[model samples]
Target: MQFRLVKIAETSKKKQTFIFLAAILLALFTTGLFIMFLGHDPVKVYLSLVNGAFGSRYRIEQTLIKAIPLIITSLGIAIAFRMKFWNIGAEGQITMGAFCASYLALNYSYLPRPVLLSLMLLGGFIGGSIWGIIPAFFKAKWGTNETIVTLMMNYVALKWIIYLQYGPWKDPAALGFPKIPNFAENAILPKFLGLHIGWVIALFLVISVHIFMNYSKKGFEIAVIGESVNTARYAGIEIFKTIVLAMFLSGGICGLVGMIQASGVNLTLSKDITGGVGYTAIITAWLGALKPHWIVLVSILFAALVQGSSYIQTAFGISAASAQLLEAIILFFVLGSDFFAKYRLVIDWKGLSRKKENKL
Candidate 1:
């Protein structure tokens, strides 16, 4: 007998939805089994997760706060991936954005609040755009491997922030402690109902991106280029320009997340400002199918996981790693199920026999 995997001509949206939901339910079931082995009730653990993420008004707000950065970063990643650009340097871009924005916050203490905030945002945008465009430029000009370049840039940006925290940018008034000084009030983002304005901005960008991608000529060009460079060239789509532009937007949005973190949440630039959101955004983007609206939903769910998992550790005595393990298991099932959605295995005993007969 022989088995062959054949691609499906077209998967219905309803089937795709069913498959993904099944993956999620299966992951939860698997995690429940593990919890049973650990002597804890799975239902209780799940309730704890829900309570941790949204039981209280305060918890809901906190979850939304975490979701803000994830939403922004994931949207940025979605933009790049739509163009088939693997921009792995979002972490670096975030770090650099925070680092650059911090310079204005730390140095220009005399500027008006509005101007300082604007300048800091611009700095963050410029910093992230530069980092993003570098790899794009090289890829466009020489066909350099963008993945490697972007990934390496992340370490470079990371080390730069670490150096700032411990070296020249270190706070002098901290009594010999190694840390960057916090931003001035003028540099900080304003809050609304316990959440920063970054959330508002993130939502605005989300809608804007959705409209831009779904209803613009430029978006069509990007889609064409992503599908095939040769086809894009045949259509006169300025391939190099589109690649660079897509990357710039991608990196710039990630940088905006960094600025928001520094100015709104952390109130300073630090090595930990990103909090792994850059990497998480990649997953969110993929899980969301690179759609802005879908990305928001995925980011919120992930944010809940992060917020709730910490509660699971404290409330249920589960290890912190368990949450991460849960995430991995869910991702595994979802990714694996995508294969079955796209293809089906067919067994062909007659074909196997014919092959064997010919060989004999």
Candidate 2:
């Protein structure tokens, strides 16, 4: 007998939902077994994780703080991915954006606080847009591989920021400590009722992206391009223009996250400012299936994992590797379940019959 996999014609929404829930439950169950093997109560560990992430108003705010950058960066990633553009350079764009915003905050301290903040936003956006444009321009003109170019750009941007932090942009008054000068009061993002305004911006962007992708002409063009380049060309969609524009918007949004991270949280620029958000947000974008609102939910779930991981280390006395293990296990199950939902196993009757006849 031979076995093979076949694609399903269609999957019902209910089945997809069930599959998603099953994946989550299976991940939890497997993780629980691992915890049990460690001589710890899995239920207690999970409850502790929930409490640590959302047991209080303060915890919720912290989770939201983490989610804000993920949300913005994921939205940016979703835009490029929607058009079949693999923009893996969000990290570089983020670093460059923060650097631009910090320049204004550090040297242009005389400007009004509100004005400084506005200019910082613009600077960050432009900086990120430029980084995105570099690879995209080459890809459009020369048919170069965007994935490699974008990935290489990430290292370049990262090194540039490190040099600035340790070199020309380093603060001289810190008594030899390698750090940049802090932003002036006006450069910082204001908090509203204990949370930074970045949340507000994130919320607005969520709605805007949904509308743009679902209702706008440009969005439809992007969708077509994603489906097939040949079809897009035949439809006269101006492939070059669409690619460049989409990448610019995508990188620009990622750059805004840099500004938010600097202004709202760190209030300074450093080599570690991005904290791997660019990469993490890509997961959020994919798990959310490139949907703006869906990305919000995925971001919250991921933020919880992050905020809770520290507590797991403290309470369980397990290494940080445990948290990573749990994350990997969960991702594996989720993707595996999705694959089953899209395909089914079938017996190869022709091969099975031949084998039976041979045996006879």
Question: Best by TM-score, which number?
Answer: 2
The RMSD of every model to the true structure, in order and in angstroms, is: 2.3, 1.8
TM-score of 1: 0.94
Q: Candidate 1 on 1-360: residue-level lDDT in tens?
A: 789999999999999999999999999999999999999999999999989999899899889999999999998888888888898789999988888899988999689998999999999888888889999999999999999999999999999888888999889999889889888889999987678999998999999889878899888788888889999999999989999998888899999888999999999888999998888888888889999999999899989988998889999889877867887788888898899799999999899899999999
Candidate 1 wrong stretches, greater than 4 Å: 347-360
Candidate 2 residue-wise lDDT, 31-108, digit = tens: 999889999999999999888889899889998999999999999999999988899999998988898899888888
TM-score of each: 0.94, 0.95
Candidate 1 achieves a global lDDT of 0.90
Superposed Cα deviation of residue 26, candidate 2 (Å): 2.2
Per-structure clash totals for the candidates: 0, 0
Evaluate all candidate structures by whole-model CA lDDT and list the values in order: 0.90, 0.89
